[model samples]
Every structure is written in structure tokens, then in C-alpha cells.
Target chain A: MPLVDSVLAQYFEDALKRADAMAPDYALLWQSLQAATYGGKRLRPALVLSAYAGLGGPDPAEAAEVAAAFELLHTALVLHDDVIDRDFKRRGVPNLAGAYRSRAAGRGVPLEEAAHRGQSAAVIAGDLALTGAYRLVAASDLPGELRLRLLEELDAAVFASAGGEQLDVEFSLPGRRPSLQEVLQMSRLKTAVYSFEAPLRAGALLAGAAGREVEAVGTAGRYIGTAYQLVDDLLGMFGDEELTGKSNVGDLAEGKCTPLIAYARLCPEWQELAGLLGGTPSAAEVRRARNLLEECGARGYVEDLVECYAARARAVLAEAALPAALLAELDGLLERAVQRSR
Target chain B: MPLVDSVLAQYFEDALKRADAMAPDYALLWQSLQAATYGGKRLRPALVLSAYAGLGGPDPAEAAEVAAAFELLHTALVLHDDVIDRDFKRRGVPNLAGAYRSRAAGRGVPLEEAAHRGQSAAVIAGDLALTGAYRLVAASDLPGELRLRLLEELDAAVFASAGGEQLDVEFSLPGRRPSLQEVLQMSRLKTAVYSFEAPLRAGALLAGAAGREVEAVGTAGRYIGTAYQLVDDLLGMFGDEELTGKSNVGDLAEGKCTPLIAYARLCPEWQELAGLLGGTPSAAEVRRARNLLEECGARGYVEDLVECYAARARAVLAEAALPAALLAELDGLLERAVQRSR
Candidate 1:
């Protein structure tokens, strides 16, 4: 296994142990947290550790904690994001809200009451995870100045993410579809920076990397992060639901102003596509929409965009004055990310 | 005007400037924020600056920023809390959610959609305020260690606040009347600590006060905070809406499990009180319930409790090794706080 992969595995194990220690009751909250933490691919954490190592960060164990903090934060975001998006399933299983609703129903609460209870519980759980994320970072033995800077970065990313979410929600309204540039800007703010750039830059900052070396990591992160989000957009519309562990074409139903949608809007024939967006759509309608997107060459356009970002990421990595081995590993990861089917 | 009051005023102006600078074009968000920030009584900031001066802290300007940060955080909390509580009015004006809802309705959205949009906007707005609070603290010229410790305390208080909210929500359910001790615990965690103790202690910390000095503020803060909460509880039950700037009897309608309710639950004729406690009582029912509370001596009992806390606060202030003038000012504030009808 690559060094970053090993670091990530170790970090995951340690994070689970820390979470267990923090919530000893092993109550429903802990159980739901464990399920959420273990469900996703550890892409964000891996990015953090990889960037750390590539920038000469020593001691994988210490770097792992930084990685773990990002994962915990991500888990909190995903849990609360699911609630905001009104999603019922995640990772092919009942999400926190769905599980809590079922538990409340089992206790014989009215359905509406149960749902309210579930949402309330999920909100609190997300908050706990957020606190837990900070505690992890604070407890790390990193230098005080470095830790503070990392924390400040994390805080800024959180605000940016919330801003992007607000814009996304607003853009879902009829006649409110943002421009393609705006959609990409929102995606970069909401996902790319936090998911890839911030964590990576934070890891590098922790390692005392500075000057051009630090700038290099940031540049590389931007490219990789943008590519990661473009791939995610493609997956949302085209990937297998069974493998992605989320609803395929659900973004279309939700009228998400993704790059694909933005590209489709450019075609005269796709003007009617706007009416089909928003609210839940049937499987057949989703299929028809998918065909429409393909007919407009939107899917191909997004794929080309993803590849362009991927190549940019590789070029940045190559130009960076890091270890060749580490750069190669990151290059391989970027290639896999863009090419992955699920 | 008192020195601390002037200092805090300047800080509020600066903090508002900083927040405005961060988002110049976000007119709706900024307008709503201005309304929320300017609506409150500025009690929390007053307490923080007062406590800092009482402890003989230097640089009241820096102390004022710390104070303003706490108040900003409190504003954020109130905005979100109103949404959670489904409150329509605050300080005799439509709150952020209500105002947003009205705007949405004016734009021709359905009532329910308008309500949801209002809520979503409020949530995001509150989030921005919360982030703005931390930004204020982080950007302050305080000592690094003190800033870090203050940030940690703020983070912990946020977690406690969220936990307390969950407990409050849980206690509202049928057959779950918590004990008076539990109510106090929740109050301390949710309101007292964050509203008074943490901010005061943080101000002291930023001033480079010794541990003993900080501990003294904490001791005094506990009593003052308890008394403050007691007054809040009383205001919820009996204060005039115009004076208090809150809806009369709304707490009772929302089934708030306050100390007053806990005391009422202890009466021998508690069954009648219980029936009237959590329900939306009519005007006659509210009058009768008020009569029952007075007849059962619950009101007097809570008043005596407030007096006891007030006395303890004075004693702690005397015991603390601080300037006599500052102590006298704090003492005067505590007495006025207890005496305030609202």
C-alpha cells in the first residue's frame, strides 16, 4: 500500500477509538456516528496526509490526527447536510435522520413527532461531531501558532461551505439558476476547498512548510480539489447508485445547479430542461433527463472538464519541489479519482 | 457614562464595522444581521467588560472587543433559538425568521414555502454570525495563549449550549418533567455559563489575570448568572411584553420547563398545575394559573432563591481581591439586574 493509504487506515482506527472514548455510553448517538464515520471513502483524510507527507511532514501518527480531525468534521457536515437535503439514505443504509425516525416510531411516537425528534437528534449529533473535531485538533501536540492557524483556516472553510450551501438552496428556485461560472464557484467553495485544499494546506502548515513549498501545495490542492468536485458532479448524475451509496440522478431531481446542468442550459433545445428540475422525479423521468443531458453533450463536456482539472493537478504536482515518490503517489490518486466509476 | 460602558460601545461599533467589511454587498444578510445585533439589550457584553475592569485588566479597548465578541455570539444564539422555538417576534419587532417569511410571502411564495425559506435564511444568517464571533476573537490583539484558551472555552460552551437545548426539548415531552436541580443544571450550562461565566472568565483570561483571579470571577459569575436566569424565568411568567420585549405567556405556551415549573410540580395540588403548565392556556387560564402559582407560594420561593443568589454574588465580589470601585459597580449592576421587572 502507498504511504498515504497506510496513514489513512491508521488514522481511521485511531479516530474510532477516540470517538468511543469520548462517548462511552455507546448510545444511539455513538452508534449512528460510527456508522457514518465508517461508510465513506476516506478521501479527505488521505488528501490531508498525502499533502503533509509530500511537504516533508514527519511522524505519520501526528499527521494522522490532523487527517482524523478533517474526517470528523466531514462526518458532521455529511450528517447535517443529509438533514438539510432531506435525504433518507446514505451509504446504502438508513441515514442518521432515517434511523432516528425509525427508532422513534418503534417507541410509538406520532410520525410527525418522530420525524421532528429525529431531526432534533441529528442536529445535536452533528454539533457534537463538530465539537469533537475541534477537540481533536486542540488536543494534538502541534505547535501553538500552527494549530491556531490551522483552526482559523478550518473556521474560514466552514463559513465558505455554509455560504455555498445557502447559494445552492437559493439557486434551486425557478429562474434562479446561477451561471456556469457561479455554479463552479459555489462547488469550489462548498466542497473543493474544504474537502481537499484546506485540509491539505492545513497539514502542510502543521509541518512548518513555508514559502514556495507551501504555495505549491495550495496550487496543487486547488487543481486536485476542483477535479475531485467535477468527478463528484459526474458521479451524482451518472454513477451507479449501488456503488455510490446515494441516489443517482437525485441532483437532477433536486435541481442542483451543477456544472452539467449549467452546460446543458447553453443548448437551445435544453431550455425545457429547467421545468423538469426541482422536487423529486420518477426513475423514468430521471432516465429521460439523463438522455437529454447526453443529447446535449453535457456529460461529455463535464468529463472533459474533469480530465482538464486532473491534468492541471498533475502538472502542479510535477512542478512542486517535493519528493518524487510522494508526487507520483498523488498523481496516481488524482488519475484514479477522475477515472473511478463509483 | 461608565468607562466599561464607553469601551464596550466603541467595541460594538468596531465589531459591526468588521462584520460589515466582510460582506459589503450582502445587503439582505447584512440588514437582517444589523436588526438582530441592534435589538438586544447588550447585557452579556456589559457583564464581560464589567468583569474585566473589576479584575483590574489593562487595555479596556481590547477587553471591549472580547466583550463584543460574546454579545455577537449571543445574538447568533438568539437568532437560531428563536427559529427553534418558533418565535415570531423579538423585542416587539418581527425576528429574522418572521421578517424573512414576510419577504418571501411578499414575493408570492406559498405560506409554508415562505416559512421554510425564512427558516433556511435564518439558519444561514445565524451561522454567519457565529463564524463572525470567532473571527472577532481570533483577530483580536490578545496574547496567543489566552486567545487559544478563550477559543477553547467558547467552543466548549457552544457544545454545552447545544446539549442543554436538546435536554430542554426532551423535557418538553409528556411525562418528562425534570427535577429542579436538572432545570438549574440546564440553565447553568445553556444560559448561565455561556451568558455570564465564560465571557467574564474569557475577559479575565485575556487580561492575563492569574488563575485565582479568574476563579474568583467564575465564583461571582455563578451566583450572578443564577440570579440573572431566575429573573429571566420570572419575566417569562409575569413581565409585561412591552417592557420585556418578549411575547407574554409564550414560554408557558411553548412548555418551557423552567425553575418556576419545577417548583410548581412540587406542590401537593400539582396535577392542576401540570395540566396548565405546558399547554397553550387562554387569558383566563393564564390568570388562574398565575393565581395558583402565587397561592402555592412558588413565586415567592423563586424570588427568595433569586435573592439568595444575589447575596452570594455580592459576597463573592467582596471576597475577590480586586479594586473597590470596580467591585462596587458590579455590585450595583447585580442589584439592578435582580430588581429589573423585565
Candidate 2:
């Protein structure tokens, strides 16, 4: 993971330099990207490294490039996601779009105009990062066959994520109410595949692991990733803002149909809870909605689901036939990921 | 060009099939993308095929794939450009985002929300096309080295386009008036490099042309591409709306700081023309602005500039010593490209 971080740092530094040479205005994009990507858990890269090592990959260098590529993919998706969600901030700070919007606002541009300018910049920034991920992989020293295979993996991740995002957006439309099963599938596709399955599988492939072994690791990743996202849904509701750097009620305000929300939709108290979800709920309204979720067992149900998936992940990893060191590393990463307060 | 069109058609058909297998909701994206790309000039592909043939390349199939990749790149950029410019239509038809917007509106979604959803989908659509360009090239049967070279060319195009888009956006901000030289550079970065220079160089490279030959083609492409964009600006302001499928006054309405505007900025009547821009001007106001541009000689000045660039392109092509067939083909393409009303 440390190696991956250094690789990413160097990669972005080179990009920033090239950007500055190209045009100073473009450098702001690189700068904003650097800031947005500063302190993620690096969970994807860790998964890549752990899987690569566990599967007996020869050199860390090749795996590092793949890891960095995933990080760029993550950044690219996050940038675009911000635009989709109309978010100007992430982790309690101004995002790339927010930075541009703030600058425009300071320059006396109208608020709507400023925001549009910012989002437009973010679109181009995402484009650069997305294609830059492929550029990095194409320029890497991997064998041609392996490079193509890895690129195919990347393509699958991108396609699935796009589908999931579209579903998420559509589900939020006025009259659409998806079932709990559909919600779970969307979350798995949106978060699990790219953040977990692809990175883990890529690492194993780099290690030249057998097909069976790769599939096994991906299965484990699927469980772990689902559990991770389910926990994220919980955190969005109840986590400490100081630690999570996100408003606990913001998801409710946005009317995001998380698994808990889906569970609530199936419950008797849903009529009252729905009233508090889609608008700017007062603090009292938020508290009452939280209590209703608890009273209706939606909160408990989602928590139990997370633990269930986590247990399944552990069971799969135990039987995966990975090396002892890697297995222990995976266990630690999984525990920290799903059990975290933030 | 025909081969490239067929290649693109088949590519989209296969992609649509895959999307259907993935999820029914995802199919609309592919459908919209296919429609958006259905009937372009296919200029980029022509350059690639021409260079490949003129340079004695053994296969048109390989060049077709490369040409199709460029078309995808063009579509991808146009998709994002629509989002940036807040345009729902292109060439008088609804774009990908517009298609999505229309669907949402038909479903009774609020206008603003529908527009947002449409733009978000366009962002994702652009992402797919941009990466799909690289994927197509990577999956081609060309030698790995050449494949890598082509991918690098694509990277260069994307980067330059992003920079150019940022500059264009920034230049449009209130109080920023750039010189004609700066406007030319922006237009070149936004259009010429990707549309002309890269494709020409790529074709020559695909044919195993010498380094000097590749560079020469790129040089000729730069001149021709600049001329083409200059002609496009003229069409935007003066061409028949029926023939061009765009409003002649739309550029003025948006206050796009084109080369013609830069020329007007240097003239005394600039103030009068400026007043008619950046807003929804009435027909009479638009007519007055056009007359002012003509009366101040900005229109004539831009026309002369176009001819100058066209002549430079001809001179460069003549001295490049390309094969007779390719030379003649390029000449024909250049004339049609620059002199067309549409």
C-alpha cells in the first residue's frame, strides 16, 4: 500500500508538471484532484497489494502501477459522482467543483453561473482522470496480453458502475420505489465490484494466480465490499460527523434510498419516515426519523445484514487457500473496513 | 470512411447487446450514443485511411479500427462539450443528454431535475465513449508498440482538449477578453489537434511512415484543421440555418469569444456588437449585430484569415511529397472541409 501511494504521488506530480507546461489554468484541475484524493483509506490499493502478495506475485512494482491505476479510477468516479450528486464538498471540505465555484463567486459571478462553471470544470477533470488511468496502464511495463486483460477488467468495472449509478439516479425519481433486493443489487454493483472485486482480482491476476483462485478471491471481495457499503449506509445515518466529516442527516436530506430506507419502505411507519427524508428536516425531525427507523427495526436489520456479509467474507477468505500472511492482512483490513465508526 | 462507419456501427450493436444482457435500463445510453454518432462527416477516419493508403500500408482493416476509435473520441468530446455549454441539441437534433432529458420530461419529471439527470447521464456516456476509444485501440490486432503509440496519441488529444475547454470556459467569464492570437490557440487546441493533427499522424504511423513523414502530415493537418475551425465559426454566424442545422446568431447569443469576435474587439463598433451578445437577443438585435460586424470589417477580416490558413495548408501539403493518391485525396478533403456551407 505504501508503494502504491508513492507511485500515485509520483504519477500525479508528473501530471501536474505536464499540466503546468500545457497551461496554467489546467494546473488548477490537477491541484484540485490532488486535494480530493489526499486521504482516502486507500482500501482498494491495500486490497490489490494484499491479494498480489498472498497469491505470490513476483515483483511489487507491476502491482503498484495497477494499484495506482485503481486509485485514479476511484478519483475519477468520485469527481463525476460529486457532479451527479450536486455535491460541492467531500469529507467536509470543498471538492474540486467547490473550489472553482468559490473562486467564481469571489469574482462576483452569479451563484448559478459559478456553480455551472465549477461543475463543467469538474466534468473535464473527471475526463482527464478517467482517460489518464488507461494512459497509465497502457504505458506500464506489463506484457501486452496481461495489459489487455487488465484493461478489460477496468472496462467491466466502469460499465457496471455506470449502470449502478444510473439505477441509483432513476430510483430517486418521484414515483419510483425499488424493492429491497433491487437496492442491494444496485449497491453491490455501484460499490462492491469496482472498489473490491476488480482490484483484488487484478492483483491476483498480476500474481499469475489460477482462474479458480482468482474467482475465489473475487467472491471474497464481493462479500467484503457489500458489507463495507452496507456499513457506509449506516455511517451516513449515525456516524460521528467529526470523524466521518459528513453530516449524519445529509443522506436523509438527499432522500438516498439506502438499504435501511428500503427496509423502512417495507415497514408500517414508512409514511411518517418518508416525510422527513426528502427535504431539509429540522434537527427534531431528523431525531424522530432516526427513532422511527429504530422502532421499525430497519436500522437493526441493516446492521445485521452487514454483520452477515462480513461473516460470509471471513468464511470465504478462510477457505481461499491464500498464504497465511496475506490471509491475516485481509482479515485485518476487512475488520477495520466494516467495523469502523467513520 | 465507409469501413470506419461500418466498424463503428458493429461496435455499437455489440455494445447494445451487452448492455441488454447487463440491464434493460442501460440500453438507452448505448442507443442514444449510436444515434448521436450516426451521420457525421467521418472526416477523421478519412484522414487515417488516406494516410494509411498513401503511405502504402498493407491493410485498410487496421486503419478502419483506428478511424472508428477517433470517431468515438469525437463523440465523447462532443458529449462532454454539450454538458459544458448547456446545449441540449446538436446539428438540430437532440443530443444524448437531450434524449435523456426528453425521456425524463415525458415521464413528468420537473424540468430542472430532468435537465440535471440528462446532463449526468451525458457525463457517464462521455466517460464510456472516452474509455471505449482506448479499449477499441487496445483490442485491435496492431503490434503492441504501435497500439501503445496510438493510445499515447489519444492521450495527447484528450489532454489538449481538456485544456482548451478550460481556457474557453475561463475566457467566457466576465471581464476576460483575449487577443485574436489567444483565440486562435484556443480553437486549435479545442478542435485542430484531435480532429486533424493526431488522426493524420496516426494514419501515417499505422502505415509505418518515416518519422519525418509523420511530422510533415501533422504540420499539414494543423494548418488545414485551423482553416476548418475558422470556417466553422463563419458558418455559425453567417451560414444558412437550414443547411448548417444551427442558428446563425446562436454564437453571438452565447457570447462565444471566437476569432471573429476578437477581430471585432479591435474595432470601434465592438461596443455595439458586444451589447447584443451573452443574452437572449431579439431577431432585430441579432440583425443589427451582424450588420455592425460587417460594417466594421471584422467579417471580411476573418474571411481573409480563413483563406490564408487554407493556402498555408495547401503549400504544406504540396511540399510534403506524399504519394500522389494521398496528396490528391487530402487536397480534395481539405477543399470540401473548408469551403462547405455546413
Task: For each candidate, report its DockQ versus the true two-chain complex.
Answer: 0.26, 0.72
- Candidate 1 error regions (>4 Å): A1-40, A61-65, A99-109, A131-145, B1-31, B138-140, B268-270, B273-280
Best by lDDT: 2
* Tens-place lDDT digits, model 2, residues A102-169: 88888789999999999998998889888877877777889888888888878888887887888788
Tens digits of per-residue lDDT for model 2, B146-195: 98888878887888888889889888877787889888988989999999
Q: Estimate TM-scores for all models.
A: 0.87, 0.97
> lDDT scores for all predictions?
0.72, 0.86
Off by over 4 Å in 2: none
Model 1, DockQ value? 0.26
Model 1: TM-score for chain B: 0.89
Per-residue CA lDDT of candidate 1, range B75-154, in tens?
A: 77787676567665776678888987787777677887777666666666766666556656665667667777877767
